[model samples]
Structures are given as C-alpha cells and as structure tokens.
Target: MEHINQVIEQLNLEASLTLEEIPQIDLYMDQVIQLFENKFTESKRNEDDKVLTKTMINNYAKGKLIFPIQNKKYSKEHLILMSLIYQLKGALSINDIKATLTGMNQKIIKEEIDLDSFYTSYLNLTRQNVEDFKVDLEDSVKDVNEEITGDKKGDSPYLKQVLMISSLVHMSNLYRRVAEKLVDEITVEKEEKRHK
Candidate 1:
C-alpha cells in the first residue's frame, strides 16, 4: 500500500519539459542523447536503461519520423518531434507513429499553426489529462481495496498488489487500443484527402 502511494506520487510529478527548457542552439547527437538521458533519468526502469541513444536517433531519421538534420546537428524542432516520438513509441508501432505525425503535420499546416504553438497547446492538454488520470487512478485503487476487503483472499498482501497491478495494466491496455483506433482513423483521413 505504501509502495502504491509512492507510485501515485511519482506519476503526479511526471512532466514534460517546457519549450524554454530546451536549448535554442542545435545539438550534436551526443549532446542530444545526454540531454534526454539526464532529463529522463526518473523514467528509466533500471540503472543502465537509456532514455535515448544515438542509434535510436539515427533510426528515427532513417524511418522519416523526424526531419533531416542540418550539418549533423538537430534543431529545436527536431528535439520536440523526438520528444513526441519517445512518448508515442511506448504504445504505437513505428508505422502508426509515422502516419500519425503525417496527419498532425497536415492539420497543423492547414490551421497555420507553428510547431512551437502546437506543442504548447499539447503540453497544456497533457497536464489536464494527467490530473484527470490521477483522480481516476485514486478511484481505481479505492475500488480495488473495497472489493478485496470483502473477500477472504484480501487478507493476502500479495493479492492486493496483484489486483492493483492488474487494474493498472487493464487501464493502460484500454488507452492503447483507443490510441491505435485514432491512428487508424488518421491514416484513413489522409488517404481520403490524397485521393480527393
């Protein structure tokens, strides 16, 4: 129960970097990797787990997930795109991510919105989503405890932990499925526009 509280606390503290926090100057691969590694240290599951690597960056470029670099240095826009990719890759396939980005880019252009403006709006939405998620998570834990309390098996601390983990995993799965559906819709929309 104590550990669960800690997990909730950590999630509440999770935040994406603001645009001002990013360097204005272009960054070489090593510097970019180091920046993400340092900033996302808390996100690592293990001591040796890397938040970002040169290989990943190269792959992203090769896959066209990001724009081409200039003179072997990545610009601020590249950093923002990479940050978005990093977040999306947790639940989306590479192809899905590519399509999603394409659709978003098209929409942004149509709306005459710059990347910085779009990202700022996205950050605000994310903050609100996180707050909503926190409330939902608290409710979920409370519900699980109530159900467990009525069952004889609830006496086992391990059972409580298992139930908690199961609930979280199911919630994550639900979100993932919804995201995939939205990506599919984006792909369809792009195809329709192209054919028109």
Candidate 2:
C-alpha cells in the first residue's frame, strides 16, 4: 500500500511517452483502486462526494476552488488531475499539463490505443529509476544548464521523462549496434574473398 502511492508519484511516463510506445500508465489507476478499495469499488455502501473535497485543493488551484455553476461536485477525473497538480507542484505549469493532455488526446484520436494491460511492473521499474536518478539527473541538468544560459529554468520536464526510457532504449539498442557491427565485418570479409 505504501509502495502504491510511491509508484504513482515517482513513475515517469514522460510527455513523449506515447501509450503506443509504453505498456501502461504505471498501473496507477489500478493502484488507486487497491489503495482505497474499501472506499471505492469494493465498498458495500456508497459515500458522499463531499468527502473527496479537501482544503489542499484550494491551495493547488492557487487558493481558489470555484464552485462550478454546473453542479458543485468533483468527479474522479478532476480529483486525479488535482492530485497530479499537487504532486507536480512547482515543477510543472498548468499550461504544460493542458498541452500534455491535448497531445495525449490527439494520440488517442490518431492511434486507436488498446489500454487494457496492467503497467504495474513498468511503473515500479520507473519508480526505482527515478529514485536512482536523483543525483544523476540533477548533475546532468546542471551540466546542460551550464551549456545554455536562461534555459527555461530548473528540471526540464521533457528531459526528466526522456532520461528514463531513453536509457532503457539505448541499452536495448546496444545489442543492435553489436549485431550491426558483426554484420558489417562479415560483409567486409565476404567482399575481400570475392575480390581475391
């Protein structure tokens, strides 16, 4: 249970992380259900929506939880986004989130994604990398900053996400590189034989 929330916050399905490319969203939604199973799908009785509202939301919206004119209740999606807002805090901007969502929507429309598989394993793996990357990411960011002045400030959310999967992708490609080198060598040797 403790590790569940840890997976959500630590998991990095960076913006470039297309659903088509990855297995799942770190199984976040499933973790949420498991975390509060008694409160949600498994509960014998229903609970009021009011309990979902919290003072923290006001702070997240910069101290303004405007009661919507279209009935004053919050849905799970809103709560989830708000929770992200809180987690991301100063690291990401509202505009960034909007753009990300818009991009995600476009991907869904463009590429009929089948979002059925559980990504808990990927999520847990990502979470582990994020922890491991703390110092490495900071150092790399610093070096990158030194290279470019006024570089849109701290922790490029873009890079943060890239560092994780790119590392894995590159690692996977290492074998490809070796295979390619072997093939090149074989071709060269065969060509030499033909020439002789």
Candidate 3:
C-alpha cells in the first residue's frame, strides 16, 4: 500500500505543459527539442534516453505527421502537433495519428478552426480525462488490494501484484481498442468528405 500510494503520488506530480504554456514565437529545431526535453523529463526512463530527437522531428515533418517548418523555425502549432504525436505514439500507430492530424489540418486550412483553438480544447478535455483516470486507477488498486487481503485462501504478495497488473492491463487494452475505433471512424469520415 505504501508503494502504491507513492506511485500514485508520482503520477499526480507528473506534469505536461498546457497549450497556453507553450511559447507562441517560432523556435529553432534545437530549441524545440530542448523545450520538449524539459517539459517531458519524467517521460525519459534513463539519462541516455532522448525525449525528442532531431531525426524524429525531421521524419515527422517529412511524413506530414506535423506541419512543415518555415525557415527552419517551428511554430507553436508545430510544437502542439509534435506533443500530441509524442503522447500518442506509445498507444497508437503512426497511420492512425497521421489520419487524425490530417483531419485537423483540413479544418485549420479551411478556416473552420484555428490550431490554437483546437489545441486548447484538446488540452482541456485531456486534462480532465487524465484526472478522472487517476482517480479510477487509485480506487481500482485499493479495491484489488482489499480483496486480496480479505481472501481466506492466503494469496501471496506475488499473486496480489499479478492480479493488480492484470486488471490495469485489461483497462489499458480497452482504452486502446476504443482509440483505434475512433481513429477508424475519423479516417472514414475524412475520406467520405474528400470524395464529396
């Protein structure tokens, strides 16, 4: 329980810069990398791990996962796009991310929405959902722990840990599936619109 609480505390302390926290001025590639590294320090597992790399950034631009840099300077919108890709890459495929970004770019290009507006809305919703997930995870962990403690069969600590991990993995898998479904839906919608 102490360990669980500590983990939760660490998670609660983990911070990502809000859309408003990102600078509006255009930044050079090195500056962009440094900014992401500072903001996402917790995400790196080791000192040697790169948070954002120049090669990855170049690939993202070339692949159209993010907007093209102008005069080797990335704008706030580019930062926002890269941030989203960084967060999603762990759970989503590059194709799915690209499709979603394409839809967003379409809206932005059409003047139906602005990048700042979209990013602000995304940040607000994501922050709320992250808070809710934290609460849910804490409650689930406590409930699992209590159940293990109350078991007369004398479950071992290993068993308890296994059960807790399994439950969390199941929940994570569900979220991943839902995200895939959403990507598919968005992609199809975009395709249909393009044809019309």
Candidate 4:
C-alpha cells in the first residue's frame, strides 16, 4: 500500500506511467477495496462534498494535494481543478469527474477561461447583484402578500434566491459536457493539421 501511494505521490493527473507500472493498477485497486471494507463509515454524501470542497480550496491555494515525494511528482495545476470536482463528492464517478475536469483544464490552457478578468468580473457582479436581487424580491413579496402560501411558489423571484445556485451547478455541468466535445474537435483538427 505504501509503495502504491509512493508511486502516485507528486504524479500529475496526466503523468505518464511506465509499461512496468501499468499492471499495478489492479493491485492498487485491490488495496482500495480492502481499505474501504475495513473503514466503513456511514454519513450523508453531501458531507463528502464539504470535505472535498475544503480539500480543493486548500490544495489549490497551496498548489498541491499531497506532499512532494522523494522523486515522483504530480501536477499541481491538475489537482487544483480536481478540487472543484471534489465538491461534487462522488455523485459523479471518479472517471466522470476526471474526464470533465480534464476538459476544463484544456479549456483553461487554451485561454477559454480568462482567470483574472473572469473571476474579478464575476465576483463584482455577484456581490452587487445578489443583494439587489434579494432586496427587490423581498419588497415585491411583501407588497403582494402578508402571509405564507401553501403552494410551491416556484414562480416567485424569491425562488431565485433558493434555486439559482443549484441551477447554476446544473448548467455548469451541462456546459462542461458540451465543451468537452468541442475540445475533441479541436484536438482532432490540431492533429490533422500537424500531420499535414
């Protein structure tokens, strides 16, 4: 188990494994299964999401998930993006998250996501717009009704406060899938052009 962990230590997400190392995945997976069996603890899945989120933020900020190995090295950039998928917390499988995050990292590599301008713009808008939306929604609701309704009230602007975050999460997932195909197309085109 220690050997398996050592081999993975500091290896980037896209790190190449030798032919000799290829067959060891089965052995490592067996260890994983044994570890899971020995330490079975039941908790809400969302708790894992919280743990993932905290781990990702810390790792990304610090630029690595696990500590450096003696010689082996993993990609810090790769794991920073992995943090986002960690919050997803296995609602999606490890393979699924890896595929999705890989595409996102490619997008970042290609300048599809402009880090400084994008987050700065988003944060500024989110800060002001969130309060505006909430205040306006409350005032509108108070003007219209003095009491609570039994219905879902899904139509209200107030619903945006509760649902928009989840809706964005869903939309982000949808867009990531769509974007992955585009990445495939771009990769193919680049390969074809290179051969010519």
lDDT of each: 0.82, 0.40, 0.81, 0.41
Candidate 4 lDDT score at position 57: 38
Per-residue lDDT tens digits for candidate 4, residues 25-65, read 22232332233223222222333423323334344335432
The per-prediction tally of clashing pairs is 0, 0, 0, 6
Give the lowest summed-lDDT range of ten residues in model 1. Answer: 103-112
Worst 10 residues of 3 by lDDT: 8-17
Instruction: Give the total clashing residue pairs for model 3.
Output: 0
Candidate 1 stretches with Cα past 4 Å from truth are: 10-13, 104-112
- In order of TM-score, best first, we have 1, 3, 4, 2
**Which candidate number has the best lDDT?**
1
**TM-scores for every predicted model:** 0.91, 0.27, 0.88, 0.29
lDDT tens digits, residues 103-140, model 2? Answer: 32344346444322223344455567656655454555
Question: Which parts of model 3 are misplaced by more than 4 Å?
Answer: 12-14
Candidate 1 has which clashing residue pairs, if any? none
Taking the tens digit of each residue's C-alpha lDDT, what string does model 1 give over 1-196? 5466678666434657679978999999999998887777787667888889888999898988886688999888889888899889989999999988865544544656588998998889888887898788788878877878889756567887788889889989999999999999988887898899
Lowest-scoring 10 consecutive residues by lDDT in candidate 4?
A: 11-20
